[model samples]
Structure formats: C-alpha cells, structure tokens
Target: MSSDEVRARVRVVSPRTSAARTRVTSIASEIDDQTRLGEVYIVSLMRSQLRLAVGVLAVLAVTLGGLPLLFHLVPQIGRIELFGVPLPWLLLSVFAFAEIIVLGWLYVRQAEKNEDDFSDLLEGR
Candidate 1:
C-alpha cells in the first residue's frame, strides 16, 4: 500500500507467469486450454486463411479490371456482336458470373483444405 512497502516487496515473478503453465488436454479440447504454442498454431492458420482469401480477391480484381483495358487496347473486340449485343455486354453478363463461380469454387476448395490441414495439425496428424 505504501511506496516503501511496495519497493520492499519487489516481486521477482509476474502474477501472470502461472498462466503460462496451464496445460491443454489436446487440440480437441476447449480453446481456453491453449498454451502459447497452440495459440501460435491458431494464429498461423488464421493468417493462412486470410492470405488465401486475399489472393483470391486480388486475382478476381485483376481479371475483372483487365477486361476494360483489353477492350480499350483492342477496340475491335468492342465492335464484335454476339446475339445482337456487343461482345463486351455478353462478356459482362456471362463471363463475369462464370468467373465469379470459378473463383467461388477455388475459394471454397482452398478454404476447406486450409481447415482440413489445420484440423489435422491440431489432431496431431
């Protein structure tokens, strides 16, 4: 309570030092039981998932963004008619959705794989 008393106490160990000694049953157990190593595993898994998501998004953005540039660079493609509509319109309506579907498939596959990999690691496989 007093400055002199507190200085005299001079605790050598942190109060939270005991928390690091808590042991987890296994990865199948509750997350609260996770030790520092387990926490690192979870953090790495999360980072991997985030990286996959960002990579998918970046690819999609580049693919979609390049379309207009392609049209502009090769103006003849814009004049090409498909079912009485400009090629760009057909591409925008058709290819855009197709690209989204493909990207969604890729994302789903990668996400599931990531989850499976994390699960296996946690399970001590």
Candidate 2:
C-alpha cells in the first residue's frame, strides 16, 4: 500500500481529576490531619443517629407502657374474644409480638439508612 493510502492509529492517555476523587483526597487529608471540619461532620452524623434512636425509644416506651395501662383501665377489654382467643392473650401473643418484630425490622432498616447516608456524606456523594 502507498503511504498516502495507509492509515495510522495511536492510543493516548491523559491524567484526569474528578470532583469525587478530589473531594475524597481532600477529606482523607482533613481526617488524617484531624481537622475541625472533619470532626464536626462526624459529630453531626452521630447526633442525627442518636436523635433517631432516642425518638424510637420514646415511641416504644409510650406504646409498650400504654398498652398495659389501657388494659388495666378497661377490664372488659381483656375478656373480649378475638379469633376464639382472649383479647389480652391475642394482644400479647399477636399484636405485641408483631409490633415488636415490626419495630425491630423498622429500626434496623432506618439505622442502616442513616449509616448509608453518613457514608454518602463521607464520600461526598
């Protein structure tokens, strides 16, 4: 083939910096240096998670504590039949137990979401 008819191809690579990479490096450096901003970010994440826990605890206390009081205040409610079982038994075995399971599952999911959010914040995502 003639030089004029021949085609040549070459590959090249250039260094590049992304916002994500830059942010990661900067944040890592700040962490390594123990900067105030990094500490503040961590504290904020902890505060949010702690606040969530406290709120859930408050709700659980109210719900679990109130149930017995409600039953005590309404004695007839305890004797009522539900699905051929006593109301109190059904409440304890089914409703309360289900609530426990649901609350545990919900707490786990929400806590995981909070952790994921914290991770995203750390990664600047």
Candidate 3:
C-alpha cells in the first residue's frame, strides 16, 4: 500500500454524540424536586432577607429606643414645645411615625430587590 493510503486507513472517527453534551435542567424544576442545589439557593435568599430585616430592625431600635435616653440626657429638649405639644411628644409621635413609614418603605423596596436578584440568579443571568 502507498503511504497516503496507509494514512487514510488509519484516520480517526470521533465517538462524540448528543448524549455526551451537558444536560440543561430548569431551575424551577430543580426547586420543585427539592434538589440540594435548589435548597442552597433558597437558603441563600432566606439569609439575605433575614440580614436585611435585622439591619432595619436594628436601625429602628436604635432610633426609637434612644429617644428616652435623649430626653433624659437633654432636659431642655422636654421643655421646648411644638404647636402646644412637648418636643418629646411631638418627636415621639410625628417624627417616630414618619421614620417608621420611611423605614417600612425601605424594607419593602430592598426586599423586592433581593427577590429580583434571586430570580435573576435562577434564570442564569
């Protein structure tokens, strides 16, 4: 046989097939199946949400809880009046309520953002 013929006879044939390709699975299906990876994803989201809640609560606690201390530390603050109401009372009522509302809004917005991030993660973005 000639050298070219010998080379052609020894040519390789690849064994690759569709089965060799990586499988694509849906993230929702993985979660529905309660897979380990799914559980990890869920835990991560929960932890982030929990951390956010704790941070907000801490801020609320420090602001609200410190009011009494502030009043005691600065007696003049109690002596001042606003619209015929004691400064402390005004702050505790209107300011506290406004702060609570703002904090609640922040909490909701951040929670939604966290959920969106989690969704993006599941979608492989």
Candidate that scores best on lDDT? 3
lDDT per residue as tens, model 2, 23-112: 676765676678997787778778988988897788878887687888889889977998889888887777888888888888889889
TM-score of candidate 1 to 2 decimals: 0.64
lDDT-based ranking: 3, 1, 2
lDDT of 2 at 34: 81
lDDT of 3 by residue, 1-125 (tens): 69889888763543343333212345667678898977888999999999999999899879998888887888899899989999889888899999999999999999999999998877766
4-122: candidate 1 lDDT, tens digit per residue = 89987887566555543333235545345686766887888899999999998899778887888998889999889988999999889898999899999999999999999988866
Q: TM-score for all predictions? A: 0.64, 0.69, 0.69
Lowest lDDT sum, 10 consecutive residues, model 1, at 19-28
- Tell me the alpha-carbon RMSD of every candidate: 10.4, 7.1, 6.0
Residue 1 error for model 3, in Å?
22
Weakest lDDT window of 10 consecutive positions for candidate 2: 7-16
- Kindly report which residue stretches of model 1 are placed more than 4 angstroms away from their true locations once superposed: 1-34, 82-85
Backbone clash pairs for candidate 1 read: none
Error of 1 at 115 (Å): 0.7
> Candidate 3: which stretches are off by over 4 Å?
1-36, 82-85
